[model samples]
Target chain A: MSPVETGRRGAAPDPSFAPEPAGAVPVIVSRDLTVGYKLHRERKRLTALRDISLSVNAGEFVVLVGPSGCGKTTFINAIAGLVQPWEGSIEVNGRPVTGPGPDRAMVFQDYALMPWRTVESNIRMPFELQKLGLSKQEIDARVRRYIDLVDLTGFEKSFPYELSGGMKQRVGIARALVSEPDILLADEPFAAIDAMTREAMQGELERFVAKTGQTVVFITHSIDEAITLGDRVVVISYRPGQIKEVVDVNLPRPRFDYDVKSLPEYSELRDHIWRLVKDEALQTAHGAK
Target chain B: MSTPDLSDGGSISEATDPNRIEDTEWTAGEAWERYGSKVVTVINLTIFFIVWELFARSGAINQLFLPTASNMFLALWDGFTTTAPPGAVISGSIRDHLLYSLTNLSIGLFIACVIGIPAGLLMGGSKYVEKILSPYVWALASLPRIALVPLFILFLGFTVKMQITIIALSAVFPIIINAWAGVKTTDESLLAAARVFGASRAELYVKVVLPFTLPFIISGIQQGIGRGLIGVVIAEIFGGSKGLGYLITRAADTFNSALLYAVLLLLVIVSLTLIQITRSLEAYVAPWRRVDKV
Candidate 1:
């Protein structure tokens, strides 16, 4: 292929990354979504998302990237059913989203673990909640397996305070995955870690997602992260966020030790998203509607 | 003056400094000066006692008005085993009064625990409920429990039931309030995490919420126990005729200064023991919270 085609590889002519399956439908669907908050008694609303319609296939990794306060997190929260959309519907596996359910698990930005519990207990929480007539041995085995998966085997007895930020996030990831939900939603899960730690965690999380074949909706401000980790990148506009563009990343599978930042395709995708985000960010900063 | 010897030899040498011994003496003196206040406290108490004993023995004050410490000790010994009389036994003996007061305190505390914990959980968990009831809690807390003795006696009819009500009412509020605050202030994200994990409401309350609130509950109980002791004593003094308060009142009426002093001492002992027990419970429940010395 020519250099021009390779550079423009991330931006397909289709201009929509809503996964088109050869056979199956998306696990999560948001149609013409608008999410917002009511400001005062006058019912003045600040729209966070506007007309965001996307489809996340059963095992696809979709990245939602934009400037801070651009409604990326709000969008994911809506998908998690933590909040209701001002307009439109979000459905998971053909079921209309109403409230939080065990079918969709969330890995929060702050690693929001129960501090009073040990790592193992945190991972076993879903089982306990479902009251799945599983025997003690079965629960223990599942907890042990996830603990191993997260490489926190020996640290199972440690509380959240005793663990480092990255370690705590690892535990949070394990806890989210232990439920084996149909979809995993992460809202800036690695934002709190240092640069080196964040990169390491991102790689680890990418590998885990790749192995599990779980549907993921990851929200982040990092453009390079979006390219490196996502099979498709969804660019969102600032306050009253609407989807600017969706670009498919046709990168090879088992994407390891690959520095997308150095690739021309990566730089091109990054610049395209930057153009859309920078204008919106400037408008928000300058108080332009 | 002869030269000081510097070595074990019999011959005198002029090298030894005689001030070294004086420096050692001064160091010892400074050490004692640093600890001098402890010694001074004992001396001051001894002097006060001597003055008191002298005044008592001289009858500068009437013997019936105030008893010497020796007489108080004798009265305490007699209250345990003997009755002062022309063959009349003391019905309100020291052992009897202690047992009566202890039973009242125990039953009251049990009732307080039964009421305080669940009430605290409800108030703490529900903001609307807490808001509606806060005024009543404030009124109860600020009310002088002693002044309510007559009301309690009137309502409950001067029985042990009246005394228990006084003690429970006095103690339960603090525990409930503290537990409620602790539960309400528990980390919100923790609860959210529990919910996402699919934990049932009951399991969330049992595992996450309760452990976090326990330290506060224990602290409230400690404070409440101290208040409860006050309640028992006040209840006895106001109307009851079976506890240490009754014992002291009767002794006071007959000009039995020695007996009155002895009963007052017993009351102090009971209060001290209860305080010590609560403190130990605090330490036992939260040993992980203790800071280690370097």
Candidate 2:
């Protein structure tokens, strides 16, 4: 199946395709999360985040948007266990994250696929990580399935460099999804891609997420992308970032199915987010100067 | 940890999977393109030999001192076909000399690889190891390795054993330094990606670090082989050992320009063959590099 048509074909657990209730069990939770880095020069601690708290229900797609260097990345990195919180705790599936775990997968902006490995091997990464006791045939079968899902079946033997930016990120998505992680955290995965490819990927991601119903935490500076894919858009503050507002996107499933920005509600949501972010950006620029 | 397989009974779309893409046109184009380069290379080689032959016959240089190209080939044929004089200590045939020199080269290079690879890996992996070894490596690599010949002659005498030591010592530095550089420069992002995917330290090295370092290590081997060739010639020329280098020395003493030119041609051919072999080996191990140098 083509990537844009992926999640649509899979059977949905809820045929009604309604927005999940707010009281649904949280798949990911962060409590008063704060992170700081030790600036070795003069031995000072530079705090990147301060007392941030948020929770995403199971199967929810949450987008976190802010200006650059606002610790949006820090928050997701903490959620991925790539960065440790100096204060508070972040949990995935009721377990506190100590380090990167198998239950979670992250899609980085750089499309961090191993250059030496082919598309097939990159997809089979999690299978090879810890021996799953599956036979070689079974492993190959699992790999082939995801390759089909990502519409990369024929390009399995191609190296990452051989692929276009959009395709490489598709492999990155396939690699992340192959592990069947409950929580998918992406760090501005589409930011570096060309505008056209970015739009296509956004739609592809929407289909993938809609079908799988996995909880997603996507970080980006694009308000349009935030409204396009997220169930709720979390507007964050400047450095030492805290949540300034969490705006619910009460849009329909498969937002990429139509021109989302053309909707009346979409404009209001976009304007609302821009108003909050514009003030924060102005304050940050003045503060920097 | 095992993930629940997602496609157990899921419907698979029948689409144009590129894995089954026919290679009919691509294979033909690739082969044609490759052969085009090979033809150019052959033409280039022919032009070089033709110029050299014309220069020789033009009397631009004395034929008695500098043999003509045809004369050199004649001497080479004689060296291969003819046997040594009555009661000689070793065979005088060029084939024997070539084989003898190759034995010393192989043994010396093998020893250098055995010691250099581990030392370089440790140096690259640990700062402590690097700190302790860096001084010695810098000094040894900088030192004129041929100068060690006199000291070696005094202690070990003019034997194959001493020659092997010379070749090994000459080759060791490049192998170690190159391996260290290769390991040190392994892509940082790839390492991070591997770690974030739940690879242990050992797994990270095996899966990511080692494959990334192979090309560097091979380049090191290339340099090591070049140095080893120089060491072999130095040992044979100075120590009067039974190799092609020694034969060249005798030819020089007797003013046998044809034999000297012949030996030089043989050396060139052997070095080219070694280089071709290594290039093929490198392309084999790192096919991804063949694509776009990832």
Give the least accurate 10-residue stretch of model 1 chain B, judged by summed lDDT: B5-14
Q: lDDT value for candidate 2?
A: 0.81
lDDT of 2 by residue, A1-289 (tens): 1111101122223343555554577777788888978888878988888888887878878899887778888888788787888888888888898988777888888988888789999989877785557898888887888887777867898889888777788788888887788889898988888897687677767766766778899999899999888878888899878889888887765565556678898899899999999988987898789
Off by over 4 Å in 2: A1-16, A36-46, A131-138, A236-244, A275-289, B1-37, B85-92, B292-294
Question: Which candidate comes out best when scored by DockQ?
Answer: 2
Give residue A259's error in model 2 in angstroms: 2.4
DockQ (CA atoms), all models: 0.11, 0.28
Q: RMSD in angstroms, all models?
A: 15.3, 6.1
Candidate 1 wrongly placed segments (more than 4 Å): A1-24, A36-48, A66-70, A131-137, A221-227, A235-238, A244-256, A264-289, B1-99, B125-132, B200-216, B242-294
Q: Which tens-of-lDDT digit does each residue in B240-266 have in candidate 1? A: 767887788888887889889889888
- For residue B95, give model 2's deviation from the true position in Å: 1.3
For model 1, residues A38-152, the per-residue Cα lDDT tens digits are 7898878788888878887777888888767889988887887777987888888898888778788888888988766788887888887776567888878877877776667
Interface RMSD in angstroms for candidate 2: 6.0
